[model samples]
Target: MVIALPDPPLLEPRVLGVEDFATKRGRKYGTVLVNAESHGVVDLLPGREKELVAS
Candidate 1:
């Protein structure tokens, strides 16, 4: 069974923190968006698409 998670709330991060991490060694990767000011997690995006994150 597939469970769909609701999309994270849209936030205008005052201080954006962008980072990339490996999900599987030499296989897959994902990006994490954070609010640098509040130190809160904004969103976790799957995949390594440069354009997606650039925007």
Candidate 2:
């Protein structure tokens, strides 16, 4: 028997974070991290808001 994996969860547009931002910006994961570090933007991982702030 074989099992199939479910599709990834659909994310909204207003969300901000590394993966979402990367997908929106069409950038690689590492590139997003580097740009965020250089620009002082929070490098937020999914569901983790340690460095996020209201803008």
Candidate 3:
């Protein structure tokens, strides 16, 4: 049987906060940036380097 699903609603764009945590896959380490206000991710940066602040 085929099931039809409704499309998800779009989120309004606004100022987003970026955060990082410890992540490892096998022997690799990385960081992930996520939005503070909304339920979304901004980007994924390589290594556990310091995060830059944007004005």
Clashing pairs in 3: none
Computed on alpha carbons, the lDDT of every model, listed in order, comes to 0.83, 0.39, 0.58
Per-candidate TM-score against the hidden true structure: 0.69, 0.19, 0.43
* Model 1 clashing residue pairs (backbone): none
Give a tens-digit lDDT track for model 2, residues 1-55.
2357775564333434443344546443332222432344344444323353222
TM-score of 3: 0.43
With candidate 3 superimposed using the best TM-score fit, by how many Å does residue 45's alpha carbon deviate from the native?
0.7
Rank by lDDT, descending? 1, 3, 2
The alpha-carbon deviation from the true structure for residue 20 of candidate 1, after best TM-score superposition, in angstroms, is: 0.1
Compare the candidates by TM-score and give the number of the best one.
1
RMSD of 2: 12.7
In model 2, the worst 10-residue window by lDDT is: 28-37
- In TM-score terms, candidate 2 sits at 0.19
Tens-digit per-residue lDDT, 1-55, candidate 1: 2367776676788889999888667599889989998888888888669987886
Q: Give the poorly placed runs of model 1, Cα more than 4 Å off.
A: 1-11
- Give lDDT tens digits, candidate 3, residues 19-47: 54564544555566666677576667666
